[model samples]
Target: MSNIQQLPSRQVSNRGMEGGRRSLCRFLMPLSFPWVLLWVLALGGLVLMPGAVLAEVPNAVPPEGTYEGEHVEQPIEFPHDTHADVNKINCMYCHTYARRSPVAGIPPTSKCMGCHSIIATDKPRIKQLTEYWDKRQPPPWKKVHDVPDFVHFTHEKHLKRFVFDNEGMDVENVAEVCAFCHGEVKKMTVANKVKPLTMGFCRRCHEANDGPFDCWKCHK
Candidate 1:
């Protein structure tokens, strides 16, 4: 009778040990087989490839880097926070033609030197700007917010119509209007594009705002 009882007890212990081994194996199998991870990644990439291709239009560059949560190396480390936030300088102070013209023309070197020539002359960034001013050359500033070549967007129309008249906002004084699409320029050390500025985004905004949806409005 005692031997029979010992046999049942031993069988129960063996079953428990087998169960524990199976649980550990189940946990470790995926990690031990790295090819499983690779196969999953490959399958995901194949699934994602078509959407990635469709997201971008042909001959048009997508908005990315810096303000789009990516970093870009700029020629001059111009801090927008210092100029816009600390100094309380308006956007038109540098981007002069934002109100009157279609293109908010890049500020000439003279505009920068207007203050920088005397102010912070000892600083390296000021020295760099001074060099460019002296040479009469533009500071090779990289274009940040570029629309599709086919799309004809005018700054003056937006400022005059949607921003001031329709939106009941000020001219260039309203940071929120600009920041709606350009991100918070006053907080950035480097200027970057925040909005995708895609046609679909523009169309949605137009539909919401009851603005013109004609092809000629944007597409040239």
Candidate 2:
């Protein structure tokens, strides 16, 4: 009788342990389902569509600058190579303020229409420029190069110091002066930032050219 009772007690305990294990499995299944599904999807994507998965990767590194190496949507697709290199049009012809002021201002729509009105009159891009001119609205030109707000870099000073005073240098065109900082714009279909334009880059150029190194020289 005693042996029989002990056997029954062991059977009940074993059943209780089995029941607890089943409860634990039920509780954990819902919690782990989403993670398991995600891993399965990722693995499936890698096996089935590797190129698509790689192309749509969320954490891919972005290219430097706001406009550099980017196909920026614009009101007009102005070809720099055609204007600056082919036609031999000067950079100052459009950006007139570069000689006198800190900013290299964008040409007004009228200035664009001045040439497009006669040249390339049949082209669709010229037609777009004409429409903007007729409406008297400025083309929403996005700036390619951006300097820090705190740093005060004037185009006038650099022009005076480097281009005019240094007679021995081969800097004849205003475009060459611009090419010192901005890369060869005459060759590009769209202007892009080639230089990193950081403080370190500026300091290295200043030190090489014997420009001012004082903290306030640029920072102010």
**What TM-score does each of the candidates earn?**
0.66, 0.65
lDDT of 2 by residue, 1-220 (tens): 2352233222322344457768966755765778678767877877797322212212112122212345565667778999988888888889888778998889877788787878889998788778878888887877778898998999878777765565554333656667667767777776777655666556556645666767777775
What TM-score would candidate 2 get against the native?
0.65
Model 1, CA-based lDDT: 0.66
Error of 2 at 164 (Å): 2.2
Give the root-mean-square deviation of each candidate in angstroms: 21.5, 22.7
